[model samples]
Target: MEFTVKNVEETMAIAYKLGKFANSGDIICLNGDLGTGKTHFVKGLAKGLEIKEHITSPTFNIVNEYDGRIKLYHFDVYRVNDPDEIEAIGFDEYIFGEGVTVIEWSNYIKELIPKEHISVEIIKIPNKNLNYRKIILNYFGEKYNYIKEIFI
Candidate 1:
C-alpha cells in the first residue's frame, strides 16, 4: 500500500500503527535516502512494542537490541561494503530469532534478506515540503497479508 505524510509525526503515526501488529520473526526492510526519517519510523515501532528506551540508528555498531513486549533487533547496514560483513555478525541468528527486526538501508544487504518480509520504501516528495514523504509498503509473503487491516 502507499501512504503520504506531511510531517514526521504522520510518518511515525503510520509506522506506529503497523508496529502494533509486529510479531516474533517479523522482519521489516526499510529503503530511503539520507534523512528520510527511517530511524524515526523505528522509534514509532519501538513505542508500539511498548519499549521505553530511546531509539537511535546503529550505523556504526551495525545492530541495536531493545527489549519490549517482544524483542527488537534494529540494524543499519549503510556502511557495509559486503554482504559477508553483515553475515559475519550472525545476521541469520537475529533474523531468525524470537523478535521483530528492522533493517535500515536494507537494500544494501538485499541478498541476505529473507524472502518473506515487509518492505517499506520512503520517498521524499520533490518540489514540495521537505517533510513530505511518500511511503510504499510491500509484503513479500502470505504471513504479512493481514497487514491490509491497517489501511482498511
Candidate 2:
C-alpha cells in the first residue's frame, strides 16, 4: 500500500502502528535516501515495542539491540561493503531469533533479506516541501498482511 505524510510526525505515527504488529522473527526492510527519516521511523518502532532505550542510527555499529515488549534488532547496512560482512556479524542469528528486526539501507543487503519480509520504501517528493515523504509498504506474506489495517 502507499501512504503520504506531510511531516516527520506522521511518518513516525505510521511506523509506530506497523511496529505494534511486530512479532518474533519479523523482518522489516527499509529503503530510502539520506535524510529520509528512516531512523526516526525506527525510533517510533522502538516506542511501539515499549522500548525505553534511546534510538540512534546504527550506521557505524551495523546493529543495535534494544530490550522492549520484544527484543528489537535494528540494523543499518549502509556501510556494509558486502553480504559476507553481515554473515561475519551473525546476521542470521538476529533475523531467525526472537526479535523484530528492521534493516535500514536494506538495498545494500538485498540478497540477505528473507523472502517473507515487509518492505517499506520512502521517497521525498521533489520541490514539494522538505518534510514531505511518500511511503510505500509491501508485504510478502499473510503474517504481515494485516499491515493494511494498521499502516494507515
Best by TM-score: 1
Clashing pairs in 1: none
Tens digits of per-residue lDDT for model 2, 71-122? 9999999989989999998999999999999999999989898899999999
Candidate number achieving the greatest lDDT relative to the actual structure: 1
Compute the lDDT of residue 9 as modeled in candidate 1: 93
Full-model lDDT for every candidate: 0.93, 0.90
lDDT assessment of candidate 2: 0.90
Give the per-residue lDDT of model 1 (tens digit) for 10-99: 988988888888889999999999988999999999988989999999999999999999999999999999999999999999999999
The pairs that clash in candidate 2 are: none
- Residue 63 displacement in candidate 2 (angstroms): 0.3
